[model samples]
Target: MANAASGMAVHDDCKLKFLELKAKRTYRFIVFKIEEKQKQVIVEKLGEPTKSYEDFTASLPADECRYAVYDFDFVTEENCQKSRIFSLPGLPTLQE
Candidate 1:
C-alpha cells in the first residue's frame, strides 16, 4: 500500500524510506517518524509533521478509524526487516 498521497509519516533513512512497524498493540497509526540518532520513534495523529521531538505523542481519536485496514511494505538496509499490518481483536467488525 504505497500511498503517495497518504498523510502517513515516513522515515528519513534513504534505505528504510518508510516508518514500517508491527502493530503489536493493535494500534492504528496516522503518523510515525524515526530519529536514527536517538533511536527514538515518534507517533502522532494524522496531521502535518512539524514537531518530531522525543517527547512528542500522538493518539488516534476514538471516533476516528475505529475500524480500518493497514497495509505494509517491507524494507531493509543493514538489518533484516519484516513489516506487519493488523487490526485490534475483540472487534472483528473492524477487519480490513
Candidate 2:
C-alpha cells in the first residue's frame, strides 16, 4: 500500500501488519484536536469488541475528524502498546 500523504510505497508486510493490528484492535492512541484547540486528545483503546480504525473514522463527526488513522511509523518499537478502549468523558458506552 502507498503512504496516504507521501504517495510512497509502503511495504506489503507493513500493510498486512496494519490490517492485522486493526483486526486485533491493538493500535491505541487515537489522537484528535477540536476547533481552536491547540493540544490533541489521545484516546486510548480500552477493551475487547474494540472498534476498527475504519469504523471509528467513518463514525467520527465531520467537523472534528481530521486523521483517519494514527501514523505508527513515528512510534518506536519500544513504545508500541495497547490500552482498554473506554468511552470518552460524557459519552455513553456501547452497552448503554
TM-score of each: 0.22, 0.25
Taking the tens digit of each residue's C-alpha lDDT, what string does model 2 give over 6-96? 3333333433433444566555423322222423223323222344556555556667443224423234578966443333332221112
Instruction: Identify the runs in model 1 with alpha carbons over 4 angstroms from their true place.
Output: 1-59, 62-65, 70-79, 89-96
Q: What would the per-residue lDDT of candidate 1 be over residues 1-96, giving only the tens digit for each residue?
A: 221233432233311222332324232333443334544333333322333322123343444433222334357795766555543322131221
Superposed by TM-score, candidate 2 places the C-alpha of residue 90 at a distance from the truth, in angstroms, of: 28
The lDDT of model 2 is: 0.37
**Best lDDT among the predictions, by candidate number:** 2
Every model's Cα RMSD, please? 14.5, 15.4
Report model 2's TM-score to 2 decimal places. 0.25
Show pairs that collide, candidate 2: 45-83, 45-84, 45-85, 46-84, 46-85, 47-84, 47-85
Badly placed stretches (over 4 Å) of model 2 are 1-29, 34-49, 68-96
